[model samples]
Target: MLASLITFFLIGLVALVVLGVVLAIVGAVFSAVLGLAGFVLFKVVPVVLLGYVIVRFLAPKEKRLAQMERKLLETD
Candidate 1:
C-alpha cells in the first residue's frame, strides 16, 4: 500500500509539472502578441500619422491657399 501511494504521488507531481509548462507556453504566446500590438499602436501608427500630417503641410501652395480661404469663410 505504501509503494502504491508513492507511485500515485509521483504521477500527480508529473501532471502538475506538465500543466505548468503548458500554461507558461500559452503565456509566452500572449506576451508576444501583446508586444507586437503595442509596438504598432505606440510606434508605427504615430509615425504614419505624423508622416501624413507632414505631407499635407507640404502640399501645393494653391491647395493650402484654398484651405485657408475656406477656413476664413467658415469663421465669418
Candidate 2:
C-alpha cells in the first residue's frame, strides 16, 4: 500500500511539472505574438495609413493639373 501511494505521488508530481512547462511555453508564445501585433498596430499601421492619406489628398490635385496642362497645350 505504501509503495502504491508513493508511486501515485510521483506520478502526480510529474504531471504537475509537465503542465507547468507547457503553460510557460504557451505564455511565451502568446507574449511574442501580442508584442508583434502591437508593433504592427502602433507603428506600421499608422505609417501606412498616413501614406494612404497623402496619396489620396494629392491624387485629385495631380489629375486636375494634368487636365489643365492638356487644355493649355491644345490651346497652343
Candidate 3:
C-alpha cells in the first residue's frame, strides 16, 4: 500500500508539470494573437473613418439623384 501511494504521487507530480508547460505555451500564443488583433483594429479604424468622410461628401449628389428618380416613378 505504501509503494502504491508513492507511485501515485510521483505520477501526479509529473502530470502537473507537463500540464503547466502546455498552459504556458498556450498563454504566450494567445498574448501574441491579442497584440496582432489590436494592431489590426487600430489600422482599420482610420480607414473606416476616412471612408465615412468620403461617403458623407458624396451624399448630397446621391440624394439629388434619388429624388429625381422618385419623381419620375410617381409620374409612371
Candidate 4:
C-alpha cells in the first residue's frame, strides 16, 4: 500500500511538471507574438506612413493642384 501511494504521488508530480512546461512554452509564444505586433505598429507603420508623406510632397505641383481641383469639384 505504501508503494502504491508513492507511485501515485510520483505520477501526480510528473503530470504537474508537464503542465508547467506546456504553460511556459505557450507563454513564450504569446510574448513573441505580442512583441512582433508592437514592432509592426510602432516601427513599421509609422515608417511607411512617413515614406508616403515624403513621396506625396515630392510629387509635381501640377499633379497636386489637379488633385485639389478634383476634390473641390467633388465637394461642390
Clashes of each: 0, 0, 0, 0
Report the error of model 1 at residue 31, Å: 1.3
- After superposing all C-alphas onto the true structure, candidate 2 shows an RMSD in angstroms of 6.7
On residues 3-72, what C-alpha lDDT tens digit does candidate 4 reach at each position? 9999999999999999999999999999999999999999999999999999989999999999999999
Give a tens-digit lDDT track for model 3, residues 1-74: 99999999999999999999999999999999999999888998889989999987777987978988999999
- Computed on alpha carbons, the lDDT of every model, listed in order, comes to 0.98, 0.96, 0.93, 0.99
**What CA RMSD would you report for each candidate?**
4.0, 6.7, 4.0, 2.7
- Residue pairs with backbone atoms closer than 3 Å in model 1 (clashes): none
Candidate 2 vs candidate 3: the TM-score winner is 2
Q: How does candidate 2 score on lDDT?
A: 0.96
Model 4 poorest 10 in a row by lDDT:
55-64
Candidate 1 per-residue C-alpha lDDT over 1-76 given as tens digits, one digit per residue, 9 for 90 to 100 = 9999999999999999999999999999999999999999999999999999999889999999999999999999
- Residues 1-76 of candidate 2: C-alpha lDDT, one tens digit per residue: 9999999999999999999999999999999999999999999999999999998778888797898899999999
RMSD of 1: 4.0
Query: TM-score for every candidate vs. truth?
Result: 0.63, 0.76, 0.56, 0.71
Candidate 1 accuracy as lDDT: 0.98
Residue 24 of model 3, lDDT score: 99
TM-score of 2: 0.76
